[model samples]
Target: MNIHLIAVPYDSAVRGWRMGAGPEALLRSGLEDHLRARGHHVATEIVEAPDDGPATEIRTAFVLAAALRDRVRTAREAGALAVVLAGNCGSALGTVAALAEDEPLVVWMDAHGDLNTPETSRSGFLDGMALAILTGHCWAPMAASLLPRPVAEDHVLLVGARDLDAGEQALLADSAIRLVHADAARAECRGCWTPHAR
Candidate 1:
């Protein structure tokens, strides 16, 4: 398979700090060579925000998302499996926008429920609102700017989420999005799982 590895090396829209270093670290660890050893052809691209670009997290995220959208679309057109290495979950908005078609099934694996909107977010972490943006619950304009369509809530499956904020928990309880607890996921893989309330 041909793999297009696009790296978004920014965390909180800022460059050269924190999680932003993750992409380079992964590359330095020989991710490309490992994939080649496994017989997959790899192409790489790195997304960098302008030094003088928007300083706010949300604004910077949108900028990165737009760039990612174009790159992901190009990879798809070239018949390559686009693999995005991103510093934060917010980069997923661009990925989903570029790839989603006819109600795509989103299997999100994470330790925390990234379902908080700006209104419900107590920590003010913009990455927490990524899923909300993808589903069009918040940041509609920003989301639409990248991709006009919103992924359906029923088609999203949240797996391995063990930590959730109060607002996120409340929202999940009232929403149609499916949840698979970490324990349940592990048990199911081992063929010893049973149905239970999330």
Candidate 2:
């Protein structure tokens, strides 16, 4: 299989800081070579934000998402699987938007629920709201600018999201999206023996 490894090395609008360093670090760690060893044809691309003045979390994130959307679309056109290595989970907006026409099912694997909206998030962290944006719970106009339509909650599966905020938990309980806690997922992996829930 052909793979397009798109890297977005930005964390909350800043470049190469904190989690932003992860994307390049993965490449330097021979990720491409490892994939090739596994018999996959791998190609890579780095996505960057513009140098226009100062960067705000919301603006820069959207810009990066738009750029990533384009690259992902190109990869799909060439029949290559587009795999994004991004620091911020919000970068998923790009990948989802690029595939919006297909109405794909989203299987999110993360420690945090990422289902917080601006109103529900105490930290005011944009990445915390990634899943909310994807499901049209918030940021409707901006999200719609990129995606033709929001992904249905029933089409989403949140796996191993053990660190959910109260608001996220409430939202999840009311939504159609399926949630598989970490312990239950591990139990499934181990067949008959289930790990004790913490």
Candidate 3:
């Protein structure tokens, strides 16, 4: 199998994280080497870092989002599967929404649902609202562009969620992303879900 790695480091609309170094962490952790040993070919594309460090972190986040969308578009044109690891999951959501199709299911693997709209979002940061953006709930133009173009609400699924805000809750009640919280499972279910773990 051939897997393409895409990294989105920041979210203009959300709080920032050490997420910019996620690619470095994975490589240093031997993720690629291990994959190769398993006979899986791995190709990586880093979201080009912006040179505006002294600026507000929010500014840097928007720059990072654009770079990631460009990479994701390139990868999509080439027909490649992707794994986007970033702190602001909401930031890269546009890319994710653009890539989603009815063929393969997209499973948002995370502790937070990442689903909040700007209006519904208590936090103005876009990262917290990624799931909300991707599902086409509410967002800025750029973030909205990355979604399914008049996005379909039924194609999303959320697993391993531990938290969500009030507005996010209201939106979730209206959309199709099914959230399976962490504590709702028994040991047997957890064991069964391990293979699909993700």
Return the TM-score for each candidate structure: 0.90, 0.92, 0.72
Model 2 C-alpha lDDT per residue in residues 1-198, reported as the tens digit of each score: 999999999999999989999999999999999999999999999998899879999989999999999999999999999999999899999989998999989999999999999999999999999999999999999998888999999999999999999999999989999999999998888865546753
Question: What's the lDDT for residue 20 in model 1?
Answer: 84
lDDT winner among the candidates? 2
Candidate 1 lDDT over residue span 1-198, tens digit each: 999999999888877569888988999899999999999999999998767844888888998999998999999999999999989999988898787764578989999889999889988898998888888888898888987688888989999999998988988998889999999998888744547723
List per-candidate RMSD values in Å. Answer: 4.7, 3.8, 4.1
Top model number, TM-score: 2
Runs in model 3 deviating more than 4 A are 11-17, 49-63, 76-80, 100-105, 148-150, 185-188, 193-198
- The residue pairs found clashing in candidate 2 are none
- All candidates' lDDT scores? 0.88, 0.95, 0.63
Clashes of each: 0, 0, 5
Regions of model 2 farther than 4 Å from truth: 37-39, 191-198
Whole-model lDDT, model 2: 0.95
Model 3 is weakest, by summed lDDT over 10 consecutive residues, at 8-17
Model 3 has an lDDT value of: 0.63
